[model samples]
Target: MNCPLQGERKGSVNRIMRELNGISVVVPFLNEEDGIRKFCNTIDKYAEKFDFFLELIFVDDGSTDSSVEILKQCAFQNIKQVKLVKFSKNFGSHAAIRAGLQYASYEISTWLGSDLQEPLELLELSYEKIREGYNAVYIEKKSIKVSKANRIFSRIYSWMMRKYAVESYSSGGISTIVFDAKVRKYLNENMEANSSIMLQAMDAGFKSTVLSMDFHERSAGVSKWTLSKKMKLFIDSFVAFSFAPIRLVSIVGVFIFCIGVVIGISTIVNKLINPNVPVGYSTLASITALGFGITNISLGIIAEYLWRTYDAARKRPVFIVSDVVTIKECESDTQ
Candidate 1:
């Protein structure tokens, strides 16, 4: 896992090139059959621009379509190395990426979706930054070509992450990331369910750089990130990394207790001043309902955190690879 340029502090572009070995590109996909071939071809085309070897690790997150079949076919292409890791079931993209990182063989690793929304040139930029001694390089999307509603949701999610999780959370989402083997090891060792890789990397206290790029429309296939999935990811990230929800619950509890105390004191004073003051049943009922609602909400948030803790303690494999298809340089020539 040692970097090709070990112990080299800073060097010119020529020196960096001389010391670089290769990069591992992890592409995690789910039911992206229509775009798999095009994606692989695009990677091969752009890969030739660099002199270093490229290892393509395609993690299939239980794709129901022929995505795996197409990947098997692409394995025979004129690529340096291609490995397909098929999951037993749909464990989600984050899990797929984690699985890919575990199997990545090169010093540097990056991830991209099967849909060609991100330009391949970003990979080159990431590599250059890694060569410049940065442990992690995250791609931030300056703008997206999605619907207005999607845009707003993205913004809100980004804002929440920055405010709650970390100030440096990538607004562009964690779909793409480039980091060296050192950072990769850290991520794998400290993996958590429903967590944000970008946030974790930023919190790793490493020297990192963010490169802003415009997100393009998908070339083929509709996006698989449904609304439910997005919401789940949001909750998972917050529960895993932020204590804001728990703290909010505590604050609400304290505020409610203070309000109750004030109400009680006011009731006693009014009763003493006017013995005929009748107790209002409606007010009592409303207060009771509010208490119940807040209690339930607080319990729910606590339950979420407890469940995540239980999940992490169990230490289940994020993804189970059902199959593998690998194409080596020597094997490709015979085919």
Candidate 2:
């Protein structure tokens, strides 16, 4: 069923507009019919309070529902411009966001989630930081009130990202961000498959500011972030940004080789001491199984890197835009 825009504004606007700048917000969603209307309403509400010219770039990530239709029919009072980019098929949120950035018109561009987990006010905060001379602003979630599984995944992913991939990565992980045109241009040119866009942007070495915030739980449609996708993201992030996995494999190989040599010498000495001792097939079998298991895991890690290399060499387009719908409301404010 198609959801209509909320009759009353759902966003809270406590502070008045401090600056006037054209802001482009890229929203990537998949099957978010339940929340897209409210999401749009939130943007409109924010526009009412804050007079900054707003340009919403909503990227439809191949939703099987009426998310796009709802967006097309939705009306806004204060939003300056709206662009809906429809993808050929489901290409994942990261790719969808990249496409949206490519189409972004404003000098300052940022992305928001359809679930509304991040507050709309972060835009103002980020804009302030940008005006203060930062190239980008990362809204780092200090704590996320999600399920146990989600919490665990977030902790592990953030830890690995900080320890291995990007050392400057936030401890709680980053979901919301605002960046200027330089970073936006960089992202538009660097198209990476099966990679984290946020990681790429951060790894590019931009002058950035971090604003700590707490994440709200989902109050609408179910999340499309499946376990398989998360696992793939984990692998992609490491392979694309870090050499730790390859280094770990090499270290494990050396350690295993040394262990094997020590075990072989011990077995030879034991055999010389007791020539009639019964052969310990159980120990031999366990050792063989462990060795094979480790070797297979190492091979799998190497295969991931190889596959990404091949994928990059293929030079496939990161995303395909099947259609685009642009709507302009009155005259947009100049930056």
Q: Judging by lDDT against the true structure, name the best candidate.
A: 2
lDDT of 2: 0.84
Candidate 1, superposed: residue stretches over 4 Å from native? 1-20, 75-78, 171-174, 328-335
TM-score of 2: 0.91
Against the true structure, whose TM-score is highest?
2
lDDT of each: 0.80, 0.84
